[model samples]
Target: MHDWLDEEDDALITTALELMEEQRKEQNKTAARGQRAPGAGGPQYSG
Candidate 1:
């Protein structure tokens, strides 16, 4: 645990957190758009 983080350190941490949040939002959007049923397969098991 760090008791004291300078202004520069704090700013970098804040910016990184914000960037991660944005990337997560973008990924969620992409996943939501791809929730359709899967395509048919050739064969699962052939006896």
Candidate 2:
């Protein structure tokens, strides 16, 4: 039972890490595309 739990925990961790990495890649692609477009909105600073 302990071994099975360990395996499940590892699988969950791996999946979470993979999802985070995919999100990072998508964010980078979006930023790059925004940079290429004309008149992209300037950064808004909130105090």
Candidate 3:
């Protein structure tokens, strides 16, 4: 039972990491383009 739970947790963590990396790449692209217009809110991110 515990082993199954561990495997599940690992899978979830791996998925999350992949998603975060993709997000970082996207953010970099947007940043290279330039900042958003005033009052036009964009994605809020954290490291």
Candidate 4:
């Protein structure tokens, strides 16, 4: 029973790690596209 529980926990951890990696990659892609226009309300400095 202990072994089974450990296996389940390992699987869940692995899945969570994979999902995080995917999200990171997606964010990098979006960032590479560059920031949105100031008028779009993305981010701007009002100097």
Candidate 5:
């Protein structure tokens, strides 16, 4: 029914938001350390 669909949608939205928040936190940590995140490519040091 409609209620079940709404619940599924809400769960999907919540999961998406949580993933975004986690990614943001990881990016912040990477920035603070001046290192590239995994799968971001490139080297962390010049020599």
Candidate 6:
């Protein structure tokens, strides 16, 4: 766990996580609009 993070560090980490979540949501929206995802695997693995 990140229990050792102080208040400032916690705030920074939370902000970074929120930004990442926003980016993920935006990417999902783009994919829903027919754009390929960042790492578009052509097909499922059969292994």
- Candidate closest to the true structure, highest TM-score: 3
TM-score of 3: 0.70
Least accurate 10 contiguous residues by lDDT in model 2: 38-47
Per-prediction TM-score to the true structure, in the order listed = 0.61, 0.66, 0.70, 0.67, 0.67, 0.59
Across 1-47, the per-residue lDDT of candidate 3 in tens digits comes to: 47999999999999999999998888776665544553233553434
lDDT of 4 at 25: 77
lDDT of each: 0.62, 0.72, 0.72, 0.67, 0.71, 0.65
**C-alpha lDDT of candidate 2 relative to the true structure:** 0.72
Ranking by lDDT: 2, 3, 5, 4, 6, 1
Minimal lDDT window, size 10, model 4: 38-47
Candidate 1's C-alpha lDDT?
A: 0.62
What residue pairs clash in candidate 1, if any at all? none
Clashes of each: 0, 0, 0, 0, 0, 0
lDDT of 4 at 42: 38
lDDT of 5 by residue, 1-47 (tens): 47999999999999999999998777566655665354453343332
The RMSD of every model to the true structure, in order and in angstroms, is: 9.9, 5.0, 3.3, 5.7, 6.7, 7.1
Candidate 6 segments exceeding 4 Å error: 1-5, 35-47
lDDT of 4 by residue, 22-43 (tens): 9877765555554553234333
Positional deviation of 33 in candidate 2, in angstroms? Answer: 1.7
> What's the CA error at residue 22 for candidate 1, in Å?
0.4
